[model samples]
Target: MLSWKPFALSVAVLLILFPFVYLVLLSLSSEWRFPDLLPSYFGLKNWATILGSEAGLLESFVSSLLISLSVAIVSTTSGFLISRAVFYHPKKNTLTLLAYFPYILAPVVFAACLSFFFLKMGLFGNITGVIVAQFIIAFPYALLFFSSFWNKKIKSYEDLVATLGGNRWQTFIKVLFPLAKGLILICFFQTFLISWFEYGLTSIIGIGKVQTLTIKVFLFIKEANYYYGALSCCLLIFPPVVLLYLNKRYVFKKLV
Candidate 1:
């Protein structure tokens, strides 16, 4: 028998890493003429320039992080409540199915459909508006993701807590949270990535006022600044990578 696991893993690694390698190479190259496999020269000057600037990469990176974090926390927390509500309802199946409608739709189309309301509310072009728009995309998926945890076994645990005189707060704090903790963390990170990489809704709702890292990457590309675009990509990859490492080392281990 032939073992293909190692070969598959190697291929997967290459597929994932090749783009990052190309981006790094492009970012570092001062000049590379045609037909060259590698750049003529490489330097950290681009990164230094991006970091030292007052109102460019650094500001955009911070703005992106703030908005993404806010969207993640708000979407996950609210979606949890919404999922619970639907879970206990008589029409749970129907409602749960309906919850996925937004998630399935293209984000640009969804945002465009709601553009008028945003304009009327004076939310268009505002950071709050961008957050709200992203939440619209993120919350539905979180709700659906969380709905899986509200199964019969979990319900029995809830019932047990209630039978023991645990009120709503006590029930959630002691029983519900403990069982749902891992799933909640997963939902948070999923929605975090959703908001972190979201550009369509943000561009539509924020009207280009809110310049996130995704937007910065596009803008840099538009200006033919591959180095800055790669820099933004690197910055965008940082938080999620760090979170994934921390989650693996701590949160997932704790869950196990």
Candidate 2:
């Protein structure tokens, strides 16, 4: 018999998707408020305006993209190298844990503490400041993903590589890394998504001048600009959706 569990699971999925459907419909709808069960009309006009306006809206989009990409590359690369160090040398864990544990703190609280230091250093409200701030949030995620393989798999592999005349870097490049490459990509994407959608830390550190989509969406909602608010929310969701789709398309195959 076909299980009831599958049917129950499918309904649950639909319920979760209903809000996204409502948002998409809201973006398309001519007008919708609490009284309405459904939108009065539907059209592409809102999307067209938001995407084609070129009125600093797109600049914000570009800003978010670049910042997320920067966070991803730097955090992932650093985490990968750091994980390699942690893997090959047991002595480094003491100092590494001391440094890395701070990343596990909530971003808002962490950024608040660091913001004071940045203010003293004259670094607040700057793009460089935001990028560097996001690195702290991104690094731990990358470390968690990359470090997993090392805990159980690397020692034997390293010994094997060494016996075969492969040094640490060579073994990393030729052996350990090739195996870990998929995990690294997943880590990069995960970190980029966090940096992309992150609001609390970005807002605290950027101080409203360095606007990301999440910040902008909050601002729009506060002003009661429901159309632009919904529009902004959808746009805020776009990058991660694209990132996930691209990963599923191009990267999932390699991992599987």
Candidate 3:
């Protein structure tokens, strides 16, 4: 008898991967028109354009990397440190609940609300503005994420450190940091992703001037340039894929 289980599993795998497979195929082809089973031209020419100034993809990729890295580093570090304070505060729950405020509004609306201040502060249409905007969103998420990391056990660890004559700085360096190393890395990865794929906030705050990769992808799609869109999409997923692999291979392993 034929095993339908194997067939079903294969079909599921193909369905899940079809979009990514088609995206890669699309990136490699050009002038693919209706009723054509394949593109008119298929080669590395599309990929090669990334290196040229015409596509502007390489620039967008670099800009996105810098902005995401900046947001992730600052948000994750600040979130981790401040989350500890929130955990110990008398109004801990209220403060933590306020962390959800940024998420309550949609990104576009939030960006719109902050637009006037960003313009006045000269943050509009700049990389720093985008980073700051994204940080506003990512920081609260990081705060909420680490909030659960500060339970009674962790407080006990702090108390233990203090009983041993260790100061706050030493306790953080020697104890808390090492204990939360995996969580911090995971938070960094999460916050990086939050900033990486952000479009609405970036679009509004950047004022169409700061072209991050996500912005570039939307622009290409808006322009009906699917070839470039697919190409940009390829660049878009690369970093997160690498980060996922690293997290799985090293971070998750240690975490387990």
Candidate 4:
């Protein structure tokens, strides 16, 4: 007989995974509607149709990927380095606020502030604006995660490097970054997810014209195309899932 502890944990995991599995099933189903209990048939038509529709869904996917990747790299790197500086200084005004605010405030309010300035500058409602907005949103996540890692695992090493013959820049490149590799990976995955699923800010800043996959799903849903909407959702959700998996395996290898 299975113990309740182990069995309950397994059930919980299955429950968590059920939605993703069902989404895949829906994406594979040829046609679906209410009261069927299950689909009449399954095929690749929905996936193929969405990919080949000339509706720019795929373009949106590419755009989201590019922006998210860019944000992940720049935000994580910049945040990680800034984390080192803040940890060393511990009293800088700007860094102090930046370290804490990203988590405390609502994202919509944050987006609003960014969009205001960006729009006045003629940078809003466009790719550049979206990229800039995403960077700001993702920056705090990287900074905080790195701050924790800095305090716990990497500080002594940084100090040792500084004492031995390494300047801060050299130690950051040679020691801090290396020691904080797992934290950096964690931040990258987090930033990527934030950028990819980010609908409101991207949509608000991009308007309707710059429709990423998440925004595309929302548009399709609002237009009442359930099948295509579901397909787009799967598309929007999976890339980050795959990337997160890769980051766990490859980037966070040291942690394991």
**Models ranked on lDDT:** 3, 1, 2, 4
Q: Give candidate 4 misplaced runs (Cα > 4 Å).
A: 1-10, 90-98, 152-156, 159-163, 250-253
- Model 2 lDDT tens row, 1-256: 7789989999999998887777777778766777989767678877777567543466678889889999999999998888767655757667567656776788999999899887887779988889999988888777766756776556788888899898878987898778887888888899889899899999998999888888878887887767666777788886778888989988898777
Model with the higher lDDT, candidate 1 or 4 = 1
Q: What is the model-wide C-alpha lDDT for candidate 2?
A: 0.81
For model 3, residues 1-256, the per-residue Cα lDDT tens digits are: 9889999999999998888889999999999999999999999999998899998899999999999999999999999999999988989989988889996678889999999999999999999999999999998999999988999999999999999999999999999999999999999999999999999999999988999998999999999999999989988887898999999999999999
Please give the CA lDDT of all the candidate structures. Answer: 0.86, 0.81, 0.94, 0.79
What candidate 1 gets wrong by more than 4 Å, as runs, is 1-12
Over 4 Å off in model 3, which ranges?
Answer: 1-3
lDDT tens per residue, model 4, 1-256: 7579988999999999998898888878855677898898788877777667565777888988888889989998898877777866747557767667866776667777777798898877788888888888788777777656656446677678878988978986787667667777778888888888888887778877778888888898898877678778888878777887788678767676
lDDT of 4: 0.79
Candidate 1, residues 32-145, lDDT tens digits: the string is 777888777798877787678743888888888889899999999999878998988899999988988998999999999999999999999989999989998898998989
Winner by TM-score between candidate 4 and candidate 2: 4
Candidate number of the best TM-score: 3
Clashes in model 3: which pairs?
none
Model 1 worst lDDT window (10 residues): 46-55
